[model samples]
Target: MIDKVIITGVSGFVGQNISRYLSECSFDTEMVSLRNSDWKSNLDGIAILHLAGKAHDTKNVSEGSEYFKVNTELTKELFNYFLESNIRDFFYFSSVKAVADEVPEVLFEAVLGNPKSPYGKSKLQGEEYILSKQIPQGKRFFIIRPCMIHGPGNKGNLNLLYNLVNKRIPYPLSAFCNERSFLGIDNLNFLIKEMLQNKNIPSGVYNFSDDEFLSTNELVQIISLVLDRKNNSIAVPKSIINGIAKIGDFVKLPLNSETVQKLTENYRVSNQKIKAAIGIKKLPYTAQQGLEKTIKSFIK
Candidate 1:
């Protein structure tokens, strides 16, 4: 078993949770910031969890170059450093966005990556850069592409739904039926634990997500369940909603085209390969169970 692990981007939501989880699992963790100049000197761990990167900007305000600089270039730098270091295992937290912004069918590991947004393109570049390099003997690498992750303190699209439900506002896009996969923080931590302990798992790209997918309608119901309130959803016509979304594209309306697509999209990701490699049949938390935990945390 690895005695210690190094994690980057410790200030972010995923990094913080992973650090706490690893501590709970009796593994010492050290946080290093890539923004700092001397970060390379502090690499003292058996494994390096590369969690630092430029996050996808929902508002579309951030510069595209920023994504390449932080997501792509920084990853290359750290990965090169890892190649030279004594660390045996390196894990990069890539996003499913690296594969596709819109999944027509179930997304598997072998799907060709065709990212649209700058964020997705940058993440894909990071993955490609790592894979292009040749690793020395006795070293392993992992590129994990996780779907929408939710947990306590994560403020994203999920928070938007939660706030809408909390305020008794009816979900407007229920008519546009779609299902999306979600990655529970606990499930992610569980996978990391399995990978760290088990030596048989191969080095490659893997999708990290819950076994089941959930629709926005079901998600509203989940929020209602956690709040102990009545579920109120409105099936607004898709045409009307899309019209408003187009208007929102120009205007600063809450129901923009981007938000609309995010709320209602078919993005089912399969985790079979990772599970088979890790030798696990099931994750510790179910979809409903994990969603409920996240909703309850929002309430508190």
Candidate 2:
């Protein structure tokens, strides 16, 4: 029964897709980009989805402070403003890294948070700011912690893998066995829609991901199929890949240390909380299906 929705970071990948999805669902939507809009007016009778934040840039360590400034400080400013406004519901997008850099054997709601990077610390700070506020009557807050999200128009490391597979490039990390969960943009859209309408969902932190997980080799296989190419995978030793990454780092090549870690690391996030909240056992799309759809979009 939500009437109007306000989405921040409208120009970014997730923001754009979420905004478009909401519009198609017949909700009155207002798009707001941090660079273009001023939030002086009180937003009465509306739900606000805040997605604007400094994203992680693996190549540049100097930008870490900026991430804290925007993700933490800007979030504090916005929360203060919301306290004065009449907005009924607020949704904040955070990352799984805020909780842990490497997924442990078990990831639960009570796990200790020890963020390794400034980006993770900033997002954790934002979540803390919201939770510290005194709950007001008729107002609800949601802090969503999503794992690596992929879909059409995604520009993260997932895209690099897709492009490499599309060009029939041989993947050298086939020997490394790693499992990771990826969130599909479409499933996220569906979850948001449910959150806006369902009054029974309690205000709290929630984790989101595809119901199933996939290993790196399986992911590459999906990409190869989408590109209509025979899978070109090599079982290179992990030590050799690490040595090449070190060399690449010294030479300032595209495949640096960070990229190497990302390709071989296993970061599996749990989505049990989100499923319980939405009363669903599975998401709308499977991990492989969603990944194939994303890879196909890169072909054009």
Candidate 3:
């Protein structure tokens, strides 16, 4: 029975979602900011969720050093404190990008590749530091590498897609086929609750995602189904789309090459390890159900 927890980065999306979820589950949570120096004094809890880290800059405007300063350095600092404290479990929220930006196949816990971006590199450094240390007998450490996490509060590519569908704009990249995995916020909270109470689950690196993978076209269809709107996907030629993306590179347009690739990329992540460890055959919500719930939230 886990009573209390200390969480950092409560201001972020995942932090806010998890904080509220845990509170609803009757667990007392203490929100702390890593920017403060006295956070060490507030570690009177069963676990510490280190969620404070710089997010990926899609515009490529952020400095490379900024990634290290927050994701790598702060992680090392807080982890050092955890090493000396009575906190029983340490959960570090990492990204699948920490392993590879481009997944040629399905990603698992053991896949190792060079992370192209600074954000990926910094997160990998944090994971390496936590694993390099020898944990105390009673303390457990979890490194969670979640793929694209989406829920009610999230505003990202999904929101854009929903808006486009609402406006009756046709999806032009239906020609490209891709399989991407998504992690629902509810599913994530459920897994965390399991980890908190079940000490039998061993501590290690786990890939966090929904049980199934969905493609962008399928996502568009799901959005349409949720909105009660007709699917407006048009199979535009790949060559023409690539040419338009090339033109978009120099102009201020929505469909850039990067954006197109992000929409149509095969980045499937496996949650088999986590499910097996938690003794669950499936997650609480299916991929379509979770996505539809999120779409409904957008309407609200």
lDDT of each: 0.91, 0.84, 0.92
Q: Highest TM-score among the candidates is held by which one?
A: 3
Best by lDDT: 3
Candidate 1's displacement at residue 77, Å, is 1.1
Q: Residue-wise lDDT of candidate 2 within 214-244, one digit each (tens)? A: 8989988888877888999999888888888
* Model 1 ranges with Cα > 4 A deviation: none
RMSD of 2: 1.8
For residue 218, model 3's alpha carbon misses the true position, in angstroms, by 0.4
Encode model 1's per-residue lDDT on 1-300: one tens digit a residue: 648999999999999999999999999999999888999885878799999998999768999999999999999999999999999899999999999989979999999999999999999999999999998988899999999898888856788988888999888888888888999999999999899988778889999999998888998998898898888898889999999999998978998887888888799999999999988899999988988988888877
For residues 1-300, what per-residue lDDT tens digits would candidate 3 score against the true structure?
Answer: 658988999999999999999999999999998888777775778999999999999889999999999999999999999999988999999999999998869998998847999999999999999999999999999999999889997856698899989999999999999999998899999999999989998889999999998999999999999899999999999999999999998896899888898999899999999999988899999988889988899998
Candidate 1: lDDT of 168? 91
Task: Arrange candidates, best TM-score first.
Answer: 3, 1, 2
